[model samples]
Target: MRIHHHIGRRTRSGLLAGLLAATSALAMGIAVAQPGTAEAAASLRSLADAKGRDIGFALDPNRLSESPYKQIADAEFNLVVAENAMKWEVTEPNRNQFSFGQGDAVVNYAVGSNKKVYGHTLVWHNQMPGWTSNLSGSDLLAAMKNHIAGVAGHYKGKVFAWDVVNEAFADGGSGGRRDSILQQRIGNSWIEEAFRAARAADPDAKLCINDYSTDGINAKSTAIYNLVKDFKSRGVPIDCVGFQAHLIIGQVPGDMQANLQRFTDLGVDVRVTELDIRMSTPANSSKLATQAADYKKVMNICLAVARCQGVTVWGITDKYSWIPGTFPGEGAALIWDENYAPKPAYQAVAEALGSGTTPTTPAPTTPVPTTPVPTTPAPTTPAPTTPAPNGSCTVTYVPNSWGNGFTAEIRIRNDGPDPVNAWSFGFYFTAGQQVTNAWNATVSQSGTQVLARNASYNGAVAVGGTVSFGFQGTHTGSNPSPTSFTFNGKVCANG
Candidate 1:
């Protein structure tokens, strides 16, 4: 999910200056609250724990030596995924000859910090050495099985999960399987073989099929959905699905929750793996705000799905984000900024995790009975007919705009005499603006009309209580706000 790159070392002066500023602020009787500090009270790790989810970051072992990086990694996250150490090239670059030095370092760090380790991958086409590509037929098959056994067996009980096969499906079109060396040499059966081998090596660890660009109900995701469905029917030992949510600003998929739900409905856990929202840098306030909303949307999506286990950001800080190198002019992709300071995205993520409802239903140990796939696809938009009026409410809309995009915070208050247990707030966007993503609710747009429903955790509102959610959207020429709103199909007063 990430391209490995070496970051130039930073001098100690930045850390020194940060400490000096904190000290000065403290001496002047000003409060300086830093993430993972007592003054902050809540951390991403602690918040995630309360929600029964793991907050994780991809760790670069090289950066573990730095005090600030180590501190943040230890204090803010409860799960650790190696950025490059566990990949094919790093662990088994020269055929049967293997090395586990760097991988061990990462595992040791995770164990020392009491964080769970999620192995990056066992079978991937891109990171394999040139020798792998040269072999075909039985020779290649043997090598792959051996590699899986060796690597998965080594980490046996140490890792909680393993990405048994990564990025095997191609993007675009019908989302056919990728024509990787493994695919061509061992044929389509290679994927099943790899999973079987991994299970043999580590019976306890959860095995997953990880892929990118499948965060929504697109061609690629549908392909993965069919694969998982097939795997379940044939009992192919897949315990989880990983959606590598490498997204762009104002472009988080609106159907992310629905997509993840469909996977979990198949009786396997789902995870947001290698998540980072990138934007063209030097990050300005507006871009950063939109980025924050995007991050919260992703977190909320994961939280909304009962079987979604956790979310792991690609990296801890923007300084080492792979975006800059892999994507020209796109650098600020992580929650933490380059100076090791928390950005708005960090705060938004923390809040979302903290407010999310803990799932009550446990993941199914045995595969649930499968239902026949409907020949007709489900409608993406809600029903056109409005529901009968149920209650009275009021809505407050606040928007922040930059260029053609904007982020809005909406507050809906219960004005009726009785408390509203579950509600849906609706509005019309008159300016041809379209919502890209939202958080604290499940938001969907059908043309100019948009509907926002309460998430699991925030469904109940007291007689006078209020529920708030935010979204990011785009507009072409005139960005006009919705003049009217509805709550549970009844027209609500504008605030």
Candidate 2:
């Protein structure tokens, strides 16, 4: 009935005004603003249903409370990712020994609340117990099999997917540390063995090869791509490629869509796993902007590709991110702020995930269904393209596929009783500069909006139906700026 409450408002006056307005509005029957239509519709950016994928966010059960978890549920997120709790040490501390207590808590919570669960890993180089170092040959394999069988078997159908192998390829090459017990004895063949074991444990779930450095056109990514391609070709039981987009302030991977497409073309799904945009230092207003911009571009990639199923932020809140501790000095890299409220990054991500940010003025009075953030096993079937209540409308996107720096298609949809006048669409550039693209939507500098404005062909798109402009901006920075634009209007929101 009211706009959901959260922390992190820049000024006290804004917070008070918001609270006052919410108190007044709560009396009405409005559910938190439904997804979105035309104006600020991030949903429009999403791939249509036939191409759906899972949208997941890693959660810390230890840090979660009933209320906050409920709040997350309200945000419309599709999947719930269990953080360290699903790892070896936390779940199975010693050999045949096991303890799903932590992971179980999360699993139960997800199941109880009707959220899908993604089992983080069956095998990884990190989070294993020290005793594993002593394991050799068949004993190690047995332990791995047992771990997979126990955990995967425990949840079975309830779990949507599993990260079967992690960081198996070294960036510098060298056979990926054959020193680890599984690799040392079983050799590279152990990876297949693990996946086979996972399938044996739970054939109903999706299997993935999760890794970093595979986010772009790097040697490591290509190599892994080949591996997945080969595995799929040979029926090796691999179904997805998880790209851990642990990005930097200005280094959004420009090859995002290409990378996902390459793998998907091989007949396997692709996902952005462990996504985080880290800064070189602690939190500041400027850095937060960088993070938001990073989040926006990342989600845009997921939306552009039909096979790029969905994404999962490694951790939802900056307070619990591994960035501060793992990278030292680099912190505040996720969508949720410290007190568990939507950060600019959260709103941006929500929008990118197809929940449009409603605009003011001509005002978005049309009530649209709040498509939950993500429920991707596959893109959902279309939600019955009903016409807008007041009149016929359409949304179209004339995407600029310079496909060089960023990957997106312009989403042009209108949902209003009357056409909007002197209107333009905008998103924050974060880098303090606008992207330069000769092939994008024609720019209209005549307006005051800073970034870009739509030329004649770009403005006043119809309602319900939409249009898109796609591109690959080649912007790179600590947390890069999007270097692609079609001048729909001056850019307003940013990371």
Candidate 3:
């Protein structure tokens, strides 16, 4: 959501085949396959247009000033979602007081550009105003309903869709609800109520439940699947299920198509809401190639699903990717590099849509590749050494040095052909450096030695997958980069 800003020198960051045929036939009063991939289409939207689907991207109000961004957005996408502007904290920062300036700006652009607006999310656990956290029972319900009504009502006719409730389930796809203020105060009914309010405000807008880690039929996704089925059975007003296919560079879920198919079978439309494949920093040819394949794999999944409506990448470019800030040592998650030029992933997406060329700009001789720097680093300390008898891991330690404090970015790559259940990193500073702050990891320091243990979210690194994190530290005199790093007591080669 681009909610986190880090400090460095500066701060950081689908109609399916079979049923699509039947549905298109019934809906259009004729049975047929989507026009054989818009071969002549210039932009992604045009390609989707050929197939009678929408191609979209999440837009950031701040990035609109960049001509290339605006140009590409207008050209490639027919649909737009507010990256963060329409969320609770931004829309209703104060009780009953609403600020639609930022969100409206995006809507205004979309309207002017002849694009459809997909309101990002009326309710989310991550970005909410502090005031709502303490409310209970009726107060919470009132606030929730009021916020949804106000935001959804104002954009009543403007938005084509709204994520009425987002990311409500816990990780591990357990079906267990997350411990959120909304859940605590209003319980499970909050979701149905929010959807109802949204419907009352804007009956035509597609109200959806969106979440990550739900691209496949995992525990989390199964939970959402059941919820959608139950909603449909009770006429709960849900129109779509948004699977935020946020994936790693080489790990697109194998059952993605089947998963979306099951959701569509429940009589609700499914969409790929936020798609991006992140890789280890200092992206090499291999990683970027894998990313391109990953993108194509996801695009194909959506293309094959009849009820899959559209596809929206989380953000437009790698420059503003939320990954680096949150994951550390891992980035280059978008199709465009920091310079607004297309990468192989862009071409891959274009090809999948049957629009073989990048839409906005001509191909550059050498596109600037995304690199690991000090933009966003995860912080951490050492943990007890656990031995890995037969695994290989690589580490990349990059320090953005300054006067006394430097932000360190570390990439931990699982080089072996298997996943590491729990990995630990330890390094010793040659200089007198003391760790000050860290995130995305459990970090501790003892004299010149630092140990970083993986947090629950990032501990497991699949074979060839990388996890990154950064930390801020104060160093006396020179801040020498750690000469050696170890993953579970095994020396890690410099990435």
| Top lDDT hit | 1
Model 2 C-alpha lDDT per residue in residues 22-90, reported as the tens digit of each score: 333233321222121224333222222213455667766755553433444323344677766777777
> What's the lDDT for candidate 2?
0.57
Model 2, which residues run further than 4 Å from truth? Answer: 1-51, 173-179, 358-495
lDDT per residue (tens digit) for residues 53-144 in model 1:
88888887888776557756755677898877888888887988889998999899876665789998898877786787778679999998
Sort all candidates by TM-score, best to worst: 1, 3, 2
Q: Give the winner by TM-score.
A: 1
| Candidate 1 lDDT for residue 185 | 83
Give lDDT tens digits, candidate 3, residues 1-495.
Answer: 347432210111111113322342244232222222111123465456556677788888787775556656755676888888898999998999999998999999886665679988898877789998788788989998999999999998899899899888888735789888888878889889999999999989999999888887788899998888899999999999998877888788889899999999899999998887888887766777789899999998998999999788877777778888877898888776665545668778878877543222222221111111122223344433534334487877767655565656677787886677777899876656777545445677765567787654445567787766556566666887876778876777776
TM-score of 2: 0.62
Residue 315 of model 1, lDDT score? 84
Q: Give the TM-score comparing model 1 with the true structure, all chains together.
A: 0.67
Q: How would you order the candidates by lDDT, starting with the best?
A: 1, 3, 2
